[model samples]
Structure formats: C-alpha cells, structure tokens
Target chain A: MPRTSRAVKLAALPDGLPGPEHFSVVDVPVPVPADGEVLVRNRYFQVFPSLRTLIGGGVKGTPFPPLRPGDTLFGAAVGEVVAAPGVAGLRPGDLVRHWLGWREHAVMPAGQCAPLDGTLPDPAAHLGQAGVAYTALARDARVRPGDTVFVSGGGGGVGSLAGQIARLLGADRVVGSTGSPDKAARLVSELGYDAAVVRGGRPIAEQLAEAAPGGIDVLVDNVGGEQLQAAITAARPGARFVLVGTLAGQLAPDRSGTTAPVEIDTFQLIAKRIEMRGFGGLDDAGPRPEWTERVGAWLRSGDLTFPHVRVAGIEHAPRALQELIGGRHLGAVIVEL
Target chain B: MPRTSRAVKLAALPDGLPGPEHFSVVDVPVPVPADGEVLVRNRYFQVFPSLRTLIGGGVKGTPFPPLRPGDTLFGAAVGEVVAAPGVAGLRPGDLVRHWLGWREHAVMPAGQCAPLDGTLPDPAAHLGQAGVAYTALARDARVRPGDTVFVSGGGGGVGSLAGQIARLLGADRVVGSTGSPDKAARLVSELGYDAAVVRGGRPIAEQLAEAAPGGIDVLVDNVGGEQLQAAITAARPGARFVLVGTLAGQLAPDRSGTTAPVEIDTFQLIAKRIEMRGFGGLDDAGPRPEWTERVGAWLRSGDLTFPHVRVAGIEHAPRALQELIGGRHLGAVIVEL
Candidate 1:
C-alpha cells in the first residue's frame, strides 16, 4: 500500500474567478482509520460553482466547513474503501461516496459513507448525479405532469440533470436557456430538451416567449439575473420557480465584493402568482432512499443520462473548476484521482 | 326608497396618483331587481392601494373587470339589501358584503353576497379585512407556532392585520416596518405588533437586526423595494415570504410608465432556503367563510382590531382614495355613502 496520499488545499483566499495559483496539491501521510472508521481511496471528486462560498468566504451561520489555507477541500466524492478494521457492514473494496473530495484519501466514519451502487458501468457516474436536481424538480418546484418547464443554465450541472428530471416527473415540454448557440443546440440534441434558446442573442423574454409560447409552468433557475426577470415575465399563472444557482456572476471575470442583483417585477409576481424557492445541496434534500434507487434504476436502464466533463488527474481539478466557473465547460466537472 | 342613486365614476384614467378632478359623482336611476337579484343600498365602500389596478389599466388575463370613464368604481362594500324580490335566505335590513363598491346602490344576485355578522358594531369593518391577509398568512406563508414574523408596510390594510394575525397564529414575536415614526409606534401600541421599526430613519436592516436578533422565520412583505431586501437579510433559514403588495411604488408621485423592481440576493436565497410567494386578493385567496367568521369574532371580542380611515360622505371618496394612493392614510380607507 502507498504510504503517501496527495491532497488539494487552498493556497490563498480567492480575489475573483479562481485560478491554479489559489490552490496547491501536496503529498501527505495517508490518514489512518481510527475506531469505527474506514480508510477510503478517493477515485473521483466533483467540482462546481457553489464551492466558491466555502473557498472564498463563509456564510454567517451554516453547517458547511469553511475552507482555509492547508485544509483539504470538501465536496462529494466516490471512493473505494481499502481498510475497514472491525467495522461491520463495511469491508475492503466496497465502493462508497462521502462528503470529502479533492483528495486521494479520506478516513470517514463507517456509517457516514453511503455505499455507491455498482449498477452504472463507470463509478465516477455515481459522483455527478447527487440529489439536489431531483429534489428541486420533484419536491421544491413540484414539476407536475403535463407542465411546461423552462431551465436557465440548462448546460450546467444542476440544469442538465434538472431538465431530464422534469421530464421523468412528467413535464410536457422542457425548454432550456444556454449562453452560446452551440450549447443551446446541444441542450436540445444531447440533453433531452424539447427546445433551447441562447441567452444573449435576443432579449431572453423575447426568445423565451417563442420557445414556450404558452409560458412556463415550472422554472428551474440556475442562472439568476435578467433571466430571472424573463422567467417571471414568461411564467404561467401559479408557476413554481426552483432557484438553484446564480451562475451569471460565477461567469464574471472578477466578482470580488459585488453581489448579483436578482431583479423581479412585483406586478408580474402578483399577477402570475409565482412561487419561488431556493434549496441547498443533498443535506437540505431529506433522505429519499427509494427515490434515489428509482433514479439509479433509470440510469442503469439508460432512461436518464448523467453528463459531465471528466478530467484525467487530480492536478487538473483546480483548472477544471476555473474553466467551469468561466463557462468553458459543460455539465458537471469531475476529476478522476 | 330613493328612485335615484348617486355613484362615484371615473372621470379620467389616472395621470399620476389620481385626484378629485379624475372622478365625478353622477346620479342614476336605481335599477329594479330582476329574476333572483336584489337591489343593495350600499352603506359603505372601501378604497385601498390595489383597487388602482382595476381603476387605471387592464391586466391582460384576469377575472378583475377593467374600469372605464362614466362607470361606477368597483371594490368591496357592505350594504343593507333593500329588496330581495323572491330570493330566499336573504331579506331586507340584512347587512351583507359584495364586490361591487364605490357606489350608493348595487343590483346583484342574492347568492353572491356574503352575509356580514352584526357582531362587530361597524359593518364597514368587514369591507376592509377581507380574506387576502388571512389566506396569505395561513396557506401561502404557513406561519407556524413559535415562529418569528416580520411585516413591511405594517401601517397599511393587509400589513396591519397580518401582524396581529401572526400573533394569533401562535408566533413568538411579531415585528413590523412602517414609513413613519408615528405609524411605527402605533403598530405596537394599537395594532398588536410586538415591535415596530420605521423604514426611512435608520437603515431597516440595522433596526430589523436589533428587533429580531434571532432573525425572522416568516415575512409578510407589503412594501417591496428596500424593505424586501431588509426582510431577506433578516430572514432565518427556511423563511417564507408571503408577498401581498408593492405599496412602495404606490406612494410614488408619478409611476406612470415605471415598474417596481423587487431585488433579491441569490446567495442568501439559497443559503437561507427562502420561499417567496405572491398572491392577488379575494378571488385568488379563495373563499374562507369560516375563517372570516373567526376573524370577525376576534374583532368583536377586542382581540383583533380593524383600523381604518372613515370618510363621512361619498363625495370625499375620491380624495380618500388619493390619500390612500399617496400613503397618507393608515390601515383601510372606507367611505360611508
């Protein structure tokens, strides 16, 4: 067994869209599993935009551990447990996903590590399709059957999965918005969107009108800005908006101390009777083991697709995250450690 | 019975906030009841901010009928049914409330008018505390026991009642925001609010933080601009914001072609997991007859108070409405015809 494990750590607090200079990977002694713990060799780690909060600053009151210099990055990662001394129901070679990422190893409590289903061919696929998108569509937005759905940032991690989830929840039509025409076309052709519109080409309100002429019944807003206003304008009466991200500011060249203003018209809000809700990640989405299994079965059957940009090694993880933030990548960005 | 009834008519569509010059009272022959209809002698009519929507312009797709010049203005009013013809369960001298208001007489189907209990001394009180505030609190916001509630524009009709209603619903604390210092003091002293903060003097966010140091669990936002931002900042995780009005723009000297921007921060929305819902009045609130009766009982018992500006005569109705639009009147504005 290798005595050393390489882990990614914050080099410095970020000033803007993060770069490789903000992170460092160092060799360290692999953590030894104490009582009731298992040593995990992390195979793959996920990256997304919201990690900036943990990396750059801290929320006043949140359960998420704030990232600091020399501290290993934290996120969802899939790994194989190499050692589980005296821990029942857990054994060596068992593939598990846990809340520790951007590292070669993790020593987690045995019961805390959820066993990953080996149904899908690629183990990394287990890391990308977490519960947030499904929870937003089914629980938060309540994307009912025969509903017309619109998703902003439809090519991003949550948006990509949310469109398919909306369909699986019985949405009649799924329309998406993307930043580039190429991504717009890809959203429809590859991501199961019935139609897609480019964000910048025309006013989103104008373009959304043509895409969903009857107006959207459910909106999964991953990019908030003018897009949020356009969604409010195009929303059918009693439409539900599940806001998951603000990638508009995430794409900025420098967003040091500035905040993204999500403007909505009060008249339209009242007239449309819109319901807007925001949700955090898996923790906020209560444990839905049956629902998760159903989703897993669909994935295994090729009914649902998990789209992601895969990087070859841990060294490329920070750059991949930077590129993902800059809108250079599509869908979930993950590194195979 | 008088053969002719004097009614307030819109002389012109509002150029700005509206004035007496834009309205005229005309005498017209009272129509005789036909079929199952009754001729109502409207004793009092209520005028508030949202009535401007029906009076000034049109909402493309809504049940609310548009107002035009030479037409009697429409709103909630309480009146004694003079003649019910052959209609059963309704009789003359029975006080009832209906949607047709700002008039001295109304011809309506007997079944359409809801009976007003004589328990509360002022029948005009029923015209003001309609089902919107009740519905917004109970169903939309789901304000629960021991929750901290915050209300913006707490001096206005819905806002005034919402603060008291929050307490009755078992809220641990109820805080309110108003435009003036006097209204702020009156919110706690007269309106059953636990605490009140004036909007303009100190930053609302700062005052709100002091008022609700633990943060607010529910927000009934009647004023939308800066107050909305303050409420969002002071919101607790899983807070629900029930949006009932946009009176911030209603106080504007001239809002001819402008729209009120409701600004929200996406990060706070996600981190806090806030749910925001907007509702129209009365019809959208659905019929809550039993709850209305309960609220009426509360008023009669001195537990809930209905505060309103009472205009003595129909001739002053237009001026009263103008004052309401200008934010000069507190609670409801009702005119005794």
Candidate 2:
C-alpha cells in the first residue's frame, strides 16, 4: 500500500532573504520500499543556513543540482522504519537517521539508514544538527585540548554545539560571536564557552583581542566578510582560519569593479605559517565513515549536546525557515509530522 | 705590513632618499688576519634598494643595523684575497666574495670567503648582483619548467636575472613589468623574457592579462602597493604569489581616520588553494644548502646567465648607492677598485 504524506516544496526562488511565500505545503503519495529499500516515517528534518543558499536559487561551484520551483526540499532527517524489503537487522518500528527529506514518510535505500541507538538522550539528537556539527568540530578543525578556539555565529545550531564540543575536546578557552547579546550570554553561561561577543556594534578585532588575549589558535568561521577580516587580524601566528560560511556576503567588491580585493599581510603568513581550510557537512558523509562513529560515540557518552528544537508541524516548515532566515531562533529549527 | 684602506663611513642618517652627504670616506689601517682568517682587497660593492632602509635609520622587523654618524656602510662585496693567515685552499690573489663592506680592504674569517672558480665565464659573476639574483630566482620562488612566470621591476638587477633564470628553468612563458618602455623592450629582446610591459601608467593586472593570456602561475613580486593588489586580482587559481620586495611602499595609510581595509575572500584561497609566501634572500640562505649548489651548477653549465655589471670604483660606491636609491640604474650596480 502506498502511504501519503505532507512535504514542503519550493514555490519560488528567494532574492536575498527567503520568506514564507517561497515555500508551499503539498500532499504527496509516499514512496514504497523497493527490493533494496526501507520505508521510513520521518520524525525530524534538519534546517540550516546552507539550505538558504539552495532556496536563493543555488550556490556556484556546488556539486548538487539547484532547487527549481515546486521541487521538494531535501536534507538529513531522523525517522522510524515501518517496512523493509530484503533488509535484515532493521525490523519494523526501528528508529533510524538517514538523508531523508521534508516529507512525512520516505523510502530510502537500506544502506542509507543507520539504526539510531536508544543510548542518545533524545532521538532527534543524532539526525541532523548534532551529527554534522560534532563531526566538523572533531575532524576538520581538529580541535585539541588547551587550544583557544573562536566559533563565529556561535549562537546558531552548529556553532552552539561546536562550542560545547570544543570544551569537551579540552579547549582552554572557547570564544563565540553572535548577533544577539542573549545568545552570547547563553553560549558563555550555559554552552561552556569562556567568552561570547555580540557582533555588529564594535570592531570584532578589539572584542576578540580582549576575549582571548593570549590569541586564537583555531577559528571555526561560520560568518565570513568583515568577521573573517577581523579574525585574520586577531589570529595568533600560525592560526588556522576555517571558512564554513559567507553569511555577511559572498562577493566582496572593491574599486576595480569586477574584481574582489582579498588582501592579507603576506608577511604574517610567512612568519606564522598559518593554514586556512574550507569544508561542508554534505561532503563530509561519504568519504569519512569515522564521522558517523565519532558523532555516535559523542552522543552516547554525552560529551556533546544541543538545545531542544522548537518543532513545527510539516505545514509550518515555511514559517520555521522564515524564523531561521530572520535570525529569530536560538537553536536548531526542525519540522516534524 | 698592514695595508691602509679608504672606506665609506656613514656621515648622517637620511630622512628619506639617501645622498652623498649621508656618507663620508674615511682612511683606516687594515688589520692583520689571525688563524682561520683572510685579508681581502675589496674590489666590488653592491648597491641595492634594501640599503635605503638601512640608511633611513632602520626598519623594525628586519635585521638591518641603524646608520650611526661614523659607522662603516656594510653591504655585500666581491674582492681578491691579499693575505691568508693559517687558512688552507685559498692563496693570495684568489678572487672571492664576502659580506664585507664599502671599504678597500677587509680582513675576516676564512669561512666568509667563497672562492670563485674560473670555470664560470666572468669573475664578477660570483660577486654581489649575479650570485644573489640567481639564488633568489632558483631557491626562493622555486621556478619550474613549463610554468608561466611573471616578474615585477624586471629591468632591475634581481628582476633581470630572475627572468632569464626562469627561462633556464624551462618556464614556458616569462613575462616582466618595468618602469620604462625601453627597459621593457630590452627585457624582451636582450634578456630571455617572452613579453614585457611598461608600468606606471596602467594597472598591472590589465597588462599582465594581455601579456600572458593564460594567467600567471608564479608571481615574483618585487614591487608592492598597487602592483601587489593587481597581481592578486590577476592571479589564476592555485597560483603562488611570492613577495620578494616592496619598493613602492609598505603600509599604505588610509586618510579617512578609519581602519585600513584589507579584504581577503577566504573563498579565493578555498576555491584555488592558492599559496602566498614571503621570502627574503637572507632568510633563504641559512636553511637551504641545496640553493648554493643549484645556483653554482646553473652558473657553471651556462644554463642561466646575467648581464655584465657597470662597475664603479670603491670611492664611487656612495655615489652609486645614491643613484640606486634614486632609481636610476637598470641592471645591477657594482663598485670595483
């Protein structure tokens, strides 16, 4: 029997900021499990800023197809397996997390679904935000104990979790920057961050310098542009600047009109031997199986944690995305059915 | 018998461009060499732009000594061994190069003297300009075969030799930028440069783009300021921007009472994986012994070549330095006595 479910679809492409009008709710017949597939009823969907880039047409140089009008919004999700076709081990009613989508139910390849153990304090923890955030913080940045780390956009889902994970990794000082003072205080008080700065008012360099007087060793930047520029200035010699977002704006324009000016004191790099790297969560999945294990272990051990999400029903996903785009949410925003 | 020699002494420190008034000729008795020491009759002295920094008092970061009223002007020079005290393998009258001074005679440790082999075409070749220029080209930039290389200030001693050496390294295309059209033509026709552009009037990026349509793979930057900015704009993905000099100026002051704005798009580095390195020939010498051997082999094999220098007498070194500081000379300027 074919199952039916409600899914969020892109109604129109956003210009700069995505609004509720850009997305529409639609009822669709649920997919059936094929010979090597499992049918899952999705309980949680991950909403992220990168998804904004998808809704705003698409990002250049990305390997995936762009979202056109009336296309289903897709991402990683946690669900319960209701049926399996020739798939052993994962029986009916088994909880799993897979790269499912905004729909209520999905038929994914059995290989895609990983059984979510009951060890996690919450089932929603392993599916989206916590999973990717923990993996990026551990592997890519290679956060070590006694290292001073700066997480930009630190009040957001990934940044919030990354702060705690850095603390768990034995970071001596964890500094975070956000647009809201409330978020800043929450990060410092509740999320184990040593310091947090509210962005947009003062020069970030002065604030960062005051926050980490010894200097910042690792920068997990989720906000590029002016913040990145400030980070380069405040960075200790040999500091590793990681580029994970361009929330400020992508193309930095200069006097040359067409060409963007990207300047660093070349002497600083030579003196410090700094290394800068960029990575994305979607690309983190295939090549690195260790990421899944690490995140799973961290969740099981309670070394890393995230705030409870404000779940909206499937029809209210557009409203949730709007809240995210408006920077009205404190933590991860997920849609549930 | 002790040899009496006339050496150029620093008379005064200059506020900007150094003149003959800043230097004074002084008569001093040359000291006798002890064990492991050799006395050399200074023949040739090098006059480079770096001397300007040494004369303008001193720079904070670099190791150049501040000029005192009566201190001897120190620089690289080629001379002939006049006496050897308890030193083996070198005889009186053997030509050698040492970091002596603007003096007629200098007695120093034997280790400072590197014997010049006659197997190389010119004796002056191992002196100041040729040796340092060739070393900078081969080691610092790591010029490779079939690479499109661009050099700024190409008519100058280091830039001229760097262009030819890049060709010898099997560079598919060697382009250069100079201050004058005559120098540009000379670089293309006389030297081994594939193309040369007259600087000063237009942006370097436009000129470089026209000269090397494929884009620059390695940039041997001698001129900074706007040239550095333009090169960064014109640089291809994965290009290596090597900062070798900053003749234009360092630290351009913004007059707006605002912060000095330097935009660095992390995306530029991420998209191209570009590597920016800064090198001083002085720093390159200690770590890499292979640099000396490579340049020596190239010199002996006739694969790399540089122009004969316009020799000034030892007494005329101060004038030659003034000329160099005023940007009058094309190729390397050396003082011979």
Native contacts matched by each model? 0.66, 0.24
> Which whole-number lDDT from 0 to 100 does residue B193 have in model 2?
90
Q: Name the candidate that leads on DockQ.
A: 1
- For candidate 1, lDDT tens digit of each residue in A190-238? 9899999887688998999899999899989888888888888888889
Instruction: Please give the TM-score that candidate 2 achieves against the real structure.
Output: 0.65
Report the C-alpha displacement of residue A17, candidate 2, in angstroms.
5.3
Interface RMSD (Å), each candidate? 3.3, 6.0
Q: Give each model's whole-structure lDDT.
A: 0.80, 0.68
Residue A245 displacement in candidate 2 (angstroms): 3.7
Model 1 interface CAPRI class: medium
Per-residue alpha-carbon lDDT of candidate 1 for residues B1-337, written as tens digits (9 for 90 to 100): 8889888899998877778999998998998999799889999888867667666574444334667887778888999899888898788999889988888889998777877755456787677464667778888888899999998888888888888888988899999998788878888899888889886588888999999999999988887888888888888888998888777776666674223566777777877889988874554223446456667778778888787878898889989988887778678888887
How far does residue B183 in candidate 2 sit from its true spot (Å)?
A: 3.2
lDDT of 2 by residue, A246-316 (tens): 55542221111211234554444433445455543433344335555566677678666666566668888
lDDT of 2 by residue, B1-337 (tens): 5457788898886655667888888889987788899999977777666555455554332234556788887777778898897889989989887878688899889887777655445656555455445555566556678788888777776787778877877789999888778778888888789998776777777888799887777777666656655565566665665656555532122121111123455544444444554453442234234444555577778766656456566777878877764556677777777
